[model samples]
Target: TVNELRRQRKLMEKLSMEDHLTGLPNRRAFFDCAERQVEFSKRKSEAMALLYLDLNDFKGVNDTLGHDVGDELLKSVGKRLSTVCRKSDLIARMGGDEFVYVLPSTGKKGSREAETRIHQAFEDPFSVKGRSLKLTASVGIAVFPDDGKTIRELLIVADEKMYENKEKLSRESKRVTIT
Candidate 1:
């Protein structure tokens, strides 16, 4: 009984640190991991990047295909991100079709390259169950020291940049559709 209790506790702890849908790290876990990465980057005098990403037009998927399909798409996105990003990178689900990545020791060039890889990841349509769906995300990158020294500051700046990119994409999409 004691062993069972301990096992259950450990499972609970793991679950607490993970996102239920994507199986990526939850926001709290991300913060913990990123805090350490930030310290490491600072000590080493290495530039790091915080990437904030938001799914484009994700609500449409949920509306047309239902929540189950939407959830599967989210999972697929997480998998694709892992494939493109470095193993050392820290990825987290920031809830509601948003994610964040902490790329330690990556400066502007590396972050840009990672962002391009991220875009390429979505070039192929996702096969979720029976439906084939295309997805894209707006990614914002903020380099450490130049952008922000601390995780909190970096996150805030990245988030703002992501929203701006999202808006720009939305406008471009609208214009194309209109024309």
Candidate 2:
């Protein structure tokens, strides 16, 4: 029993920075690493970027289906997001259908490409419990030094931008519905 407990504890440590549900880095893990990266950028005078993302209509799925389905959807989204990012980039799930990407040594052009890739990743349908569901993610981007000097400030700006993007998406969705 002691050995098993130890093993479990080690596993948790390895995964401690990640969300157990989606297998994406948790906020703690993301921010810890991101802060270091920001400091490095500051020291080196290199560029960096932060991307904030949120799933639209995710709550509707959870309400219409169940938590199990909702969780599966989140996992799929996480996987797709990972596929979109570069090997050097960091993708983390902040919590509850929200995710972020930390782009180190990246410029505005690179950040734009990353954002576009992430958006394209969600273009396909997600299959859950034999059902094909469509979803979209709103992305907010903040460039390093250009947007803010520190990780905390960058994140705050990114989050604000994310909400603005989400609002745009909502308006588009409503327009389509009305049409």
Candidate 1 residue lDDT tens string, 25-48:
999899999999999998999999
Put down candidate 2 lDDT per residue, 61-122, tens digits, no spaces. Answer: 88887889889989988888888888889999999989999998998999999999987887
Each prediction's total of clashing residue pairs, residues at least 3 apart in sequence or on different chains, is 0, 0
Q: Which numbered prediction scores highest in TM-score against the true structure?
A: 1
Tell me the lDDT of candidate 2. Answer: 0.88
Candidate 2 ranges beyond 4 A from true positions: 1-9, 174-179
Model 1 weakest 10-residue run by lDDT = 170-179
Error of 1 at 66 (Å): 1.0
What RMSD does each model have against the real structure? 2.8, 2.9
Name the TM-score of candidate 1. 0.93
